[model samples]
Target: MDNFLQVLLDGVLNGLVYALVAAGLSLIWGVMDVINFAHGEFLMVGMYVSYWLGFILKIDPLFSWVAAGLFLFILGAVTYKIIIRNSLGKSGMAPLLATFGLSMVLKNFCMNRFTPNFRLLSGTILEGKTLSFGGAIISVPQLVTALFALVVLSLLYWMLKKTRLGWAIQATAMDKEAAELMGIKTENIFLLVFGIGGACVGITGGLMTSYLAVYPEVGGLFSLIAFVVVALGGFGSIPGALLAALLIGLVESFSGFYIAAVVKYVAVFAVYLAVILLRPRGLFGW
Candidate 1:
């Protein structure tokens, strides 16, 4: 029973990381009505930013999160101006294909620049820290990451609910044409949305460096999971995405502990299917 409780606790902590990683995808999907296949690349870019900073600047990943966030925001803004912006208002496949191709370009670019070696950052503040409760050992770094995710979720929620920028974004999402009619600048809104989305995942990527390895293909590992979280949460629902991510994280943790590690993700998807069947709009999509 104690073991079960520990697993439950770990699962809940891990679930919030899923929310952080998927938050950007959910935001981009909600704001632009575009399925950004390249969202993972933004994460990859943020990882590299942290990796290089740690290597060259002697700054830890956690402290370098703001840098990663700003860098990816610019990257996202440029991407939108160069690719996504042009593809908007066309067939849905336009942005999808554009992002898909952009993703390949970014990946290959990284492969060429950094090679395929897996790099791990050492000596971060959260390194070598753990807590024991009964029979369960808790990782401090993971716990901290989860707390950071919670902060990010709260900040996003506040921005969307309490600010003028939030209103602009909401109005734009509701109807871009209508928003334009009301004197809101749709172009700027798209730019801001993309930038905000990029910053979210970028910070996540940097934060994850405390525990995960950095490699060219690392982003792809979480990319599918991020998409699943977004889908499970409902299209364009930030709160829904956050909740779904936490649920999937718990599902993965519990299944990996009690069932097979190999089928853990399968378990998460099974839950997603069940939940979707029951609530097509998702838990908090409305």
Candidate 2:
């Protein structure tokens, strides 16, 4: 029972990070109707930014999060304007292929610049710290990351629920033509949505670099998971993303423990397939 509780807590913590990544992907898809294959590269950029800041500038990893997020936002906006916007109104495959190509380009760029070796940033903040409850142990970094995720999700919820820009985004998502007719600049909204989505992934990058190793191919793994989460949760549903993330996290954790570690991801994939087959519209989609 103690071990089970510990695993559950760990899963929830890990789920929060996945939720952050999925939220960004879902947000972009919801508003712009563009599936950003390069979304994970934005996260990779964030990891690199945090790495450089912590290693070179001697700044704390947490403090450099804002810088990473802003940089990715600008990059996302530019990419939207130059590539995504041009592909709009074309076949769905247009943006898909373009972004897929863009993702490959970014991955190769990182490989050339940073090499394919896995790199890690060592920090004392979360090292060797654990919370114990009834023979269960939880790491400090996991706790901090979970709290950070909560704060970010809360801010996002407030933004989408309260702000004018949020309403614009929502309106645009619901009906782009209607939004344009109502004086909403759909193009500008796309840019903003893309930027915001990138920023969200950037935050995940920063948080993840502290816990995970950095490599050129790292983004691809999470990007795949993000897609599953988005599809499972419903393409554009924030709440659904949160719930699905937690569910995946728990599944991964328990499967790794009770089932073969190598096949744990297979379990996750199986669940994803079952959900999609059973509910084609997703948990909250349509």
Candidate 3:
């Protein structure tokens, strides 16, 4: 029971971080109907930016998170202008292939530049602190990760539902032609949504750098999980993503502990398959 509780708790925290990573993907898919296979590579770039900022400029990853976000936002926008713009409204597979190609370029660049070395950030304020409840140990970094995820998610939700820009985004999402007739500037909205997606993952990467290992492929792990969350929560649904992420996190934690570490991902994938078999549009596609 004690072990179960510990794993469950850890899963909840980790799930929040997963939701943050998935938020942008959901946003882009919801608005632009683009799968963005390269989204994971954007996260890789964010982690590297945070890592290098810490290594070279002596800025803590926490302090440089905004920088990482800003950098990725610009990159995402430019990517849309340069590569993604041409692929819009074509075949269903065009954006998918384009983003996949982008992912390859990014992964290769990072592999060559960083040599696939796993990097860790040291001396962050939340590095080694822990709280124990009975026999279960909760780490400070993860708790903060959860808190940060909650705050960021809340802010994003508010912006999407309450702000002028948010309304425009929604209008565009409902019907692009109608939105354009209403002067919504859907292309800009698409650009902004894509940028926002990159920024969210970038911020998530910074939070992860507090304790997680950094490498070119690290983003792929999170990206896969994010896709699962998006599917589970319903594509482009923020609240759904959060709920699904927590569910996944708990499942991963429990399976990893009770079953085997090597097969924990199998458990996660099993959940995805179950959802697909039972609910193709996702558990909460509505």
TM-score of each: 0.96, 0.96, 0.96
lDDT of 3: 0.89
Best by lDDT: 3
Which residue pairs overlap in candidate 2's backbone? none
Which residue pairs collide, candidate 3? none
Q: Which tens-of-lDDT digit does each residue in 98-202 have in candidate 2?
A: 888888998899999999989888864665579997888988766776788778877887888899988988999999899999999988999988888888888
Clashes of each: 0, 0, 0
Candidate 2 local distance difference test against the native: 0.84
Per-residue lDDT tens digits of candidate 1, residues 30-100?
Answer: 88888889888889889999888998898998788889999999988998999999998788699999999
Q: What is the lDDT of residue 239 in candidate 1?
A: 83
lDDT of 3 by residue, 90-152 (tens): 888998999999999999999999999999988887788899987888988888878888998
